[model samples]
Each structure stands twice: as structure tokens, then as C-alpha cells.
Target: MRRNWIIAEFTYDDLIAVYIVDVSQVRGNLKQIDNSRLDVTYEYYPNDVDVFIFQYSVDLFMSDGFPILERPILNKLYERKSLYSRSGYGRVANQVYFMVEFPYRKCGLLSYLNPREEQLFQRWGAKEIHLTAAWDGKVIWRRFGYQPPEDEFAILGLRYQHWATIHGIEYQEPQNINDFPEEFLKDDCVKLITMYKVLEECI
Candidate 1:
């Protein structure tokens, strides 16, 4: 009935939302992620952990403007790939987690995947799907037909410092979402989408 937050200590602040993908409904969604030209890959982890990783570069801001968001990710792309290759495992993931970072503002991630990737997951048995992002980013998700969970941080046993560490970013844990820095809250933040709704839509 509820989602699980899989928090890992990484070079970046990452809060992977874990979900069980409906075996029957994921085929089409898989196709969508595959068809889209995004660099995506998944690694298998033994003992029931599956790691899915994806990367896409976009020019969200002018080529020269410091590009606060892009720099860190762009720089660590190779390192991440290397790390996943070493520790990631392959299996019919009954549970899946996605950590995607959107263009600036600050601190949040996305779960938007292309067709091929989704297909691979479906083929493997991706049952549970989890999403994590900044509090403000929930607004962006709503625009995309996603209904987010309320108070995910409290519900998921997660906090801002954990998120900051996962992404290797500086994080000042806010006592309340409203207390977030105006600049950071100006753009996307973390959020999640459940598999039940995903199935409902596919149906």
C-alpha cells in the first residue's frame, strides 16, 4: 500500500523511489522508454536488488552560464557508469528505482525513462516502481500526469541530508518545505509516482 525509499550513500544525493511494476501493463511503457533516444542501462544486484541507470545531456541554460546543474553530473558520468558496472546486478526486478536530475533550480531527481529501458524492465518483471525528487519538483511531476504522494519525506524515512549525500551536493536540511531557499525552490524538486496509477493509465 505504501512506497519504500531506498537510500544509498553515493557521491551524489540520491533517493531512489522503489516500486513494483505491473507485469501486464509495463510492455507499452517499456517501448516508450526504448524508443526515446536516451542513454540508459541497468545492472543486476544479487539478493534482490536491481540497479537501473540512465543519462541524457541537455542544454538547459546558455552554453556559458556556469550551468550549475550540468557540471557535476557531466563530470561524474563516467565514474557512475564505472561504479554501476562493478556493483550492479541483473534480475527480474520485482522492484525498480529511478534517480533522475532535472535542469537546475536545485536538488531533485526524475524517473522519466525512454521505451527500450522500460521494455527491458518489463521483460525482467519490474513490479514495484519508486520515484524520489525534491519537494518542489512535485509540481513538475503533476504537469506530466503524475499524482505524487503527500509528505513523501516523512513517509519514506528520508531527509534532506541523506538526499544531499547521495548526489554529492551541499544540502541544508530544511525543517519545512517552505523554509527551502527561494532560489532552490524556484525549480524542480524530488517526487514519486506509484505503479498502481501507472497500471490504471495503461489499462
Candidate 2:
């Protein structure tokens, strides 16, 4: 039987030790899905104290019974690379916070994974989460409640104007994700900005 193993451990307190074990269990559960195997790395930075990073990647294959071309997009072979970090301070002192970087996964897989990850974050006392949304993620992450910081709204408005001018579309300042023009959704060439959520809003 395959099992999840720790690549490294640098625990300074009970909280971090428990967090590490929780991550291992999550990895094990991930492996059970479609008999997929995952490579996970967990690291703790002592110099920064209270900073931890976790990364994992997996490639899932479809069953032979499924027709290659007919397979749903979600079931098609795709690699997922995700990175997460926890910090002690951000917008508050001694806060448990998370920064999600370069997380790319199919919607179906994310449906299975996000709740589990959120549970871990909540248990670890996460107060905020930040991430940069890219590609289709700009839409997906917004649906998950991440929004641009207050200061970023102006910058996004400027970007919207630029895109509208290039695409010959009407320009309207977008104050939030919902206000963005439809063209922004279809244009992958447009760059997205960082988004964040205060945990209290969701929890």
C-alpha cells in the first residue's frame, strides 16, 4: 500500500507538529483518489519562525475503459502543481495566514481538495489568505471569495480601460470581479492582480 511520507520536518511547537501530521493525512487521502500518487514537500523555516511551506504535484490518468477523446475534461490527464505557505503575521499580529501560489488544478479536483485544505487552515487558525489568480483561475478564484485588495481596485480599473481600448469595447471601471466586463473573462492575455480574503468573512 502506498502512503504519504514527510520530506522534512522542523517543528518548534505543538501547533506546527499537528499541522504537519494533518498535511500527511491529506496527502494520503489524495493518493486514494483514482489511485493517483503525489509528491509532497513540507518545509518549515526556523529563521523566519512560524513560516511553513507546502508543495505538492500529481498527474492523474484516466481509466482504460474511458474513451480518450470522449473523456470529460476533468477526467483527462493533467498535472496539478500547488504551493501554500503559512505565516505568523499579516495585517495582524501573530496571525495564522496563508499565501497560495501557483495552484493549478481542474475544477472537479479542486472541489474535492479545497474543503479539506480549508479545514486544515481553519484548524490552524488562519485569519487571512492571499493568492495571485491567473488564466481561468482569475474567474475560479473570484468565485471562491478572493477579491483584490482595496488599493488594487484603481489599478484594475486602469487595466480594464486599456483592454477595452484594445478590444474596441466600452470602458467601465470595474470595482470588483462582478463589475468586470465580459471581455476580460474571455481574454487570457489580460493579467490579473493579487487577491485576498479575510477568513472571518468566510468562516
Candidate 3:
């Protein structure tokens, strides 16, 4: 049950810890990533792998400011299950890899997303999710809960006044979980999109 680091080209220097999500329970617990087990190459890691999902969390410092710990999913290894696309834009997502980056801090490319990444998130019932600097903006990160309630960057980006009018949280980002049968939020999100200032003030 142990191996050596096989994929050598994609190692991030500041990575603090590696974890594998054990879905054997409700979703699952994060098992610390074992560098020794990194022995499997990408070719086999996502290919022959099945039955468990992995998340890599790293503690990073953005700049001379404070140190914040954010989770950039390194890879989502999904077990091969029957897949059907309702919207006509569906395809088999063997496994998905996510690449993350922090524009500043001199830190380089944080991680990589392999394929069908978004589909996997939607399938398992994520509230709202995001990929940093990835065009989609906060639209994705809002999955778990409320994430600052605006589709703008964390630093210098200004919030668009039309947030409420934008769309409901469920609609902007929908999940397949039973908890949120209506994954799309109501017109509240859309309305907020238009009046971001008001929402900001209330928050």
C-alpha cells in the first residue's frame, strides 16, 4: 500500500499537506497525503484508481500580508460510473484535474485539473465552488456557502453593482445533491447582481 513519487514534473514547492477524501462514510474524511504513495504515475493514478476522492490542501502566504490557508483541489479521482449528459454537452469524465494559481506572492502555478472537473463537483452536491483567477470568477466558489456574495476578485477587483439582479445562488451554480433539490438560487441572486452595493452594505 506504499510507493514512491512517480510524477516528478508537477511538484509544488510550498505544498503543506496532501489528503485523500475517504467517501466510505458520508462523503469522507481527508487522509493525509503520503509522499511515499505518490509513487504511482499519472497514467495509472487516475486510470486504475477507483472508489475514493482526493483533495490537496496547502497553507500558503499571499505576500507580505497575512497567511491564509486555501484548498485548491489537486485532483478529483472518480470511480468509473455510468454517465449520461442531459444538456447534450455531456461526456465521460474519467477523472478531473484542477490547476490553481495565485497571481501574486511570486508563488507559481498552484495545481492542475485533469478533465471533467466541473461535472464531478456538480454530481456530488457541492454548494458553490470556484477556481482562482479562472475566468468564471466567484460563480464557481460559491458552492459550499456564501462567499462574499459578489463575482469579483479578492483584491483589487470592484464588485459590479448588479449582483442581486444577477441570479439566484441555485441558478448560477446548481448541484445534484438532494439537500438542494433546487440548486439554482431564485431571482435574489440575479437582483443582487444588479444592486451589489446594497447587498454589500447589508452584509
- List candidate 2 stretches off by more than 4 Å: 1-39, 47-88, 91-107, 185-189, 201-203
Report lDDT (Cα) of residue 80, candidate 1: 19
Tens digits of per-residue lDDT for model 2 on 83-186?
12233343211212222222223324444444544444444445555666656667776777767766666677777788889879877667677788555855
Tens-digit lDDT track for model 1 on 116-178?
333433433333223333354444433433333345434422544555566686776554344
Alpha-carbon TM-score of each model against the true structure: 0.28, 0.54, 0.24
Q: With candidate 1 superimposed using the best TM-score fit, by how many Å does residue 99's alpha carbon deviate from the native?
A: 8.0
Model 3 quality (TM-score) = 0.24
Whose TM-score is higher: candidate 1's or candidate 3's? 1
Ranking by lDDT, best first? Answer: 2, 1, 3
RMSD per model, one decimal:
15.6, 10.5, 16.5
Candidate 2 lDDT: 0.44
The most accurate candidate by lDDT is 2
Of the two candidates 2 and 3, the one with more favorable TM-score, higher being better, is 2
